[model samples]
Target: MERKKRHPQGSGPTFDQLSAFIAQLEAKGQNLDNPWLMTKILSKFTEDIQRQVLEEKVPSDDTRWNLRQQMHCLDMVLTQEEKIELQLPKRSEIKTLESSKKEYGKTKDIRNVKFCFYSDEKDHWSTHCPVFKDPKKNSQHLKNTNRCVGCGFRSHTLAECKSKGCQRCGKKHHTSTCFEAEASDFDRTKVKSDDARKKTASAGHNVVDGDEEDDPEAQESSTENSEENHTVLTAKHSATKRENQEGSNIFLLSGTLRTKHPHSDEFVQLTVLLDTGADRSFIEATLVHDLELPQQGSVLMKLCTFGNQKTTVKCMKTRLSIWDICGKQHDLNPYAYKDLTQGNVQGVLDIKDLMYINEKKIRLSSSAHGYIEPHQPRVIIGCDQLWQFIKFDEPQFTLPSGLLLIPTIIGYMVSGRKFQNGDIPELLDIHDTSLA
Candidate 1:
């Protein structure tokens, strides 16, 4: 007896059966509108036929078989329209990759493949293989054999490795250039230890010994000696120290000459000081007459104070020869006053009136001989005029060393009269209440 074949339930058509049927149709080159094949296939698969009708249009025998084969391989059951929706390549069609390679090798047309040239015009050229261009496309490729995978140079690839040049020095070697290498490894701990030792040594040396009253006589003598030493040290180190006092008083002496009124030819120079404390600079009447300086006719000026007391006096413009300690000279136009009673001086110099005045830091001290009386030659230099030439250190109140001392000729207003009596009435009144 012959064995009977069994059909699996719900089992769709197998891919091999569909593929074979499609292959035969393709070989015969059937057209898409064949109704005979469509009816035969649809009747065999009723459910699939309905699904195909709803989803897609009917296809030729070749397309239908091709889609059925793919669907069966994917474990899918398709309707008649789905089978018809499948499209198959013509028998005369060529493979894309193979055609691309052939066109690239024959014409070197970059559009035929994925490669592009790195030129200004951005010309695209194809490669025989995706990995390598054909030798016929460019002579450079033939000469170099192949391109470098690492750097894209035709001479060598990474697999046929060659020496890589140093990027820093442009040398055909690794980064071993003398100028590019690290100088030395830094040892922060060693640096810190050295600094600590120096600080400790300085602190130890600065420690003072003994109390202030340990030796009364000895201390007195030491104090005197220290004072002398200080003077000597200051004088010695003064040359190296820069003048930084912004408001230091500056004094200049003008050469003297014979006056017509005095009738005696006594060479005298006007002494002028830049007084930042006072609003203006002043000169003694004696010096002004002796110097025979140019004088502009007098004008009335009012002098006042915070107390609102005012005094009117005549001011005259005068040109005086001024000389600095640095040996520089200037012709200063300063105001002179008619009333000497207002101030002990002949004129008060106001720095703001000066045309081109240069200021400098000067050091003044009381003379040990006491030849000059106190308040006799007292001069006040204001801060506004002085600030332009120097900078000050508050703690020292002295100028730093090495700053240039420039000579400037400035025009200034000299107060015609002194401040009114009530300007500072407190100075005039002395109270006996303290004694009582």
Candidate 2:
């Protein structure tokens, strides 16, 4: 006789228990990503709890809190931002609080509640601000402070000081920062001292000085070279910063994605961003609120984000069926990364399970993407898998070096736009650094 397979059994927590559990997790800075755990917690929510969450408990009886709506309410409560703006107390609430304080002969200073930049009102929206018009009166007045470093006054910001020609030798610059000017003054002083010494020696006896005075021309050339080198260094530093900024910017492929659990008969469709370089696939927590998949084994892994920032990512793995928009399912064992994203791109497809098709789209398993939508794919395909779908075709060129340099990084030098008529799709190498 065949034996029945054992399954992970769990009952949903009560509404009160679930709420408290969520609060504890949030306090510890934990993120919920396990679809099974999420299902268990929300399943036990009573109609009263759901109504309370949806504000349906209010005196208005017309409020209908559907399953999706209730799930969204729970999701909003679970998520938080690094910098949460505090909601100011309403005028009525402030008045009530002040009245209560007055009963005890106390007063409350609530001046800090005002946050509008365009208004002087204690409480106001930007649209109601009176100073928004005629901004000259409301401006920060930064131009008035643009005093000249040379003059120490507002007449001219870039021009030299007319009052004190040059502080160093009445020539053209400030004494502190003028190295060349200071050197010239030192040379002049040395020449004057030598002339005085020679005149004094001639008065006493006949004396001839054989040594020649130090050359100012050589020193001046050296100073000019130093200045030129400093300028070159500054230009190089600016260039390096520009290159680093360009290299660090993100370029992710986006498209619509459809996914479902292994045991689930129904597929859930969502928009996903593919990380063309992530080791494992991931799904957003919010998208799995309705999914009832059993919890798989938990794993702890080190994840490195942009700029090589290392962090620990707690994940739960389960076999997921990735379906094409046409309903074709692709077998993929993907992990649900706890609170990885905060948007509609619910799942990140792995590059290992994907292949680029034609010249315009990417294929997940065998289903390819075409056209565009509001929520496109943001899936980051991994490098190892990306290599398989990428191949370069070297165009014919007669050169002297006898070397074929496949232009990967700088494809812009060859082409202006992509997919023009008569353009062969196979020759288009998007996986190269040009697009990658």
Report the number of the highest-lDDT candidate: 2
lDDT of 1 by residue, 16-52 (tens): 4644676687779864335565444443344543354
lDDT of each: 0.33, 0.37
Q: On a 0 to 100 scale, what is the lDDT of residue 140 in model 1?
A: 50
What's the lDDT for candidate 2? 0.37
Error of 2 at 413 (Å): 24
Which ranges of candidate 2 are over 4 A from the true structure? 1-251, 260-267, 306-309, 325-328, 339-371, 374-436
Top candidate when judged by TM-score against the true structure:
2
Report the C-alpha lDDT of model 2 over 1-436, residue by residue, as the tens digit.
1101111124344334555667788689775645565445554544444344546324434335333444556544433211131356667888887776652113543323543344435675322355544323223221344534333234454353354534555644333223444355678889888887676476332222222334444344444333211100000001124323332111123344456644665554554443442434555443344465445554444443223443444445555455544455555444555444432221222222122222313323212342222232323333323232222562432112121111221110011122233644332112211110
